[model samples]
Target chain A: MSHDKPAWYERARKGPFVGNSFDARARQAIEKRIAGKGDPRRRKSAAVATWLVGAAAVLLAVFIVVRLQDAVPSAPSGNHPVVGAGTEGSGKNEGISAAVVRAEGTAETGKLQVVPLNGEKQETLGAASCMGKETDMQFQGSYRVVYTRGKESGVVIDELPEMTFIQPSADIVQMTKLAFADADVFLLVPQYADCHGLNFYAYAVDKNGGEAFPLSFRMADGTESNASYYPPGELPAVRDGQLVLPSGEGPGGETANGPQDRIFDLNLSEKALVQSPAAMAGDVTGDSGKKALTRSFVFSGQTYTIPYPGDYAEYFVHAAEANLFQIKAGTKKKLTSFQEDEKGIHYVKDGRTFTAVPSIF
Target chain B: MEHEFLKHMTTMDDASLRDIMAQYGSDIWNYAYFLTKNRELADDVTQDVFIKAYYRIETFRGQSSLKTWLLTITRNTAFRYRRSTFFRKVNLFASITSIQSGRSAETEYMEDRYVDDIWDVIMKLPDQYREVLVLDIRYELSTEEMAKLLNIATGTVKSRLHRAREKVEQNLKEVRS
Candidate 1:
């Protein structure tokens, strides 16, 4: 060693005493302490005395937190005004929102094609031919898609495949990319082709401009079915870093009382797709209490009025089942059911303990 | 020493608490200060460890020395302080400002004209390795004692300490050059 160990070790050992020392303060505090002169009644009185002070401190903390939260608002609640879902017959110059659809077998022309979203037979998207099978495809903003096919890779820009050829291998394609904002999230879909028809893969991109890794999903149904997705501006807006993707349609097709579409909130940072209790029915107006009801809840200082679909009682049951929201009364408990009257929705956990909803959702 | 601490704490008297604080307070503060590299945090952690030790003394099964037990509390408290929302937000703001200013610790260290002692280089090591090195050098703790404190295998502590020393030495050589 260049320098002797003992000299530097001695120096480093004294590093804590360089500027500040806690001994005097500690010695003073410890010396002034009167050891356990046991009095339960006095202890109880002391507790009561401190309780008010603690409560005031807590209230002050809460007030500051609320004020700070209000200063920086969460995503605007209510209807997510979509920029546009997709524009049909619009020129390439016009902003065309693109989404990748898995082609079963091949098209009528005996090649993979991108048809209009309206189920109308239109011109295929890219002019470039696919060398092999493409799967786990997703739309990048403005008619561009980052996709992988067999071992070949390409970025489809302006309806043209910028293709790169690579030797096909039996190994499953485990990596796919979702480009949102400036950067991309490298997702590990793992055998994406075989499970294309099974589960909907929603990619929540981190917009803060770094390559985010790991993709997760919340599968509502156990069985496999045809899966579809909506790219960025198509569905409910990404609120407070939470992107709600309508994963799949209900088993019941097109009825007033039919099962509503299951929606999952994709939080990329947490690497979790939380199944939300809210179903995807059309635009839910606040006054329209038939399909969904708008119940306003104050979080921090900001008031968020989201459309609550289904019975208020059923909503709590589902919410508890999903573990999406938790309520704290005396003790923290997942709510079971709720009732609404003159005050607000009263959420019940055990038969006895009932607190209002939106206290801490 | 461990038995003596246990006997004193069993009394739950003023003198017992004072004795524990007098004996272990400086060591705990040094450990915390080295790990956090912040005097304020080290002071807070030292106080917190003593308070926690007072409440949770009954649970201290006497398997480890009182010093190790207290140091364990100090480490946990230090980490908890780091993870708090206020600390995280402050750190995030500092990071953003530092990023904007184009001033990183790496750049600052590389720019340092004078080669200081090994402590400077030791502070530059990653959190895990740096912590192990601090405990090893500052306290001269055995591998078993470290594993008990850190809740890791003794092998991990040994390897991390070795790696931390190597990195510190390498950085020191670089600075000297």
Candidate 2:
């Protein structure tokens, strides 16, 4: 095995050892198949018959399309009324009849043409570009959230005559409902960023419309900042009306005490996310236990890590004014001063102070 | 060896067929397991691949290596099984049973800690990335061969390989740390 190759590659190359029993079974099945006992090949006549049936089906489809085209007259080019429109008060959205119209100049983009089920005039919404072939629309109270899945996936909200398009910084993977204290419904949208992995965004939906924002958490420095958690198989869950964000690592690489779950209390009245008192109590161990320090933050989408000077356990108690080093690529560069706050990690290099959220991983 | 195998494939008897299976059965089974992520399905798909290969040997035009051709058949057979309703029902039942058992075929096979960690990371990746990594690392296929096998552009294969490697490296670092 080459040193450059990942450790798993060698084991994978060897592959799984499907033993003598598998070989015996496979050989028996193959022999039976060759002897024309297992799934015998179709006869030449049957094969020809199947081909003829397929061809007839295609010809019939073409004929039907031609006849339909001749029977139905084409409407005027712009703002044409769609045929077979759904009846009033039908579908998931009651009293709202909507049709997806392909954009005039583009083949991949489309617009949502909303027509009231009560015989109201049809109105055209904003451009709802679909990255993939399929577009999904869901309702949160009266508001409709249209999600387009693909490369440049985005969400569009239809608020009657107006449409609000929300394009997150990264590709949106999925959108789910987040339980909030207020009457307004919030969507927990997870977006996939190449550099940062997966980050969740919270979108608030109200009678006025809907707006997208990142989930914020109060850091160790007693300041509120946008927070992102990496939850792979599991999603953020709500327990007792509190949002529990499970992270793989603590604020920093302080896993000696095991992983930490950050719980947040959503305070819509102050429009701020406050860490729950119970969670805060769990963080501090009466100064006698190990202090789990956070030296990591997620900026933009990527994570950057700031390494400790030496042994973290020894450095925690004795080292106070030691120089900090930031690892870039494989090399570590010295920093004048490093500070961890709610906003991000602030460091001084070449007489300049810069703030960054070093990646915990 | 592939040339010799192909030369005898037309006039292949029971002995030749058994030789062929003996030589490539594990590869086909592993490839099927990688695609379906189920041991039982892998067994069925591997058997089906060989049977299909036996019947379709005349259609093989020597465009690619015999192993690549067999792998391609394995991929298609595994995907067909996945698309079948029977496979879905079985998958659901298997998921429940596995949950109850608290152990999987993967855990049984990969006992080494580092190998198990790597397998976990690879399994967590999206299907597209995982497929490319398995083909490149385990099968040792060229980018062109992978593109041909996946029905994608060579550029797409390269980009996927790059991203897959990056993700694996990053995840491995996290696991080790």
Q: Which candidate is the best by DockQ?
A: 1
Predicted structure with the largest TM-score when compared to the true one: 2
- State the fnat of model 1: 0.12
* Model 2 docking grade: incorrect
Model 2 stretches with alpha carbons more than 4 Å out: A1-8, A16-22, A36-361, B4-11, B85-87, B90-115
Q: How many residue pairs clash in each candidate?
A: 0, 2
Clashing pairs in 1: none
Score each candidate by Cα lDDT.
Answer: 0.44, 0.48
Shift of residue B141 alpha carbon in model 1, Å: 1.3
lDDT of 1 at B29: 77
Q: What value does the lDDT take at residue A201 in candidate 2?
A: 36
RMSD of every prediction: 22.0, 24.6
Q: Write the per-residue lDDT of candidate 1 for residues A12-41, one digit (tens) a residue.
A: 665533333555655564343333433455
Deviation of model 1 at A74, angstroms: 21
Whole-model alpha-carbon lDDT for candidate 2: 0.48
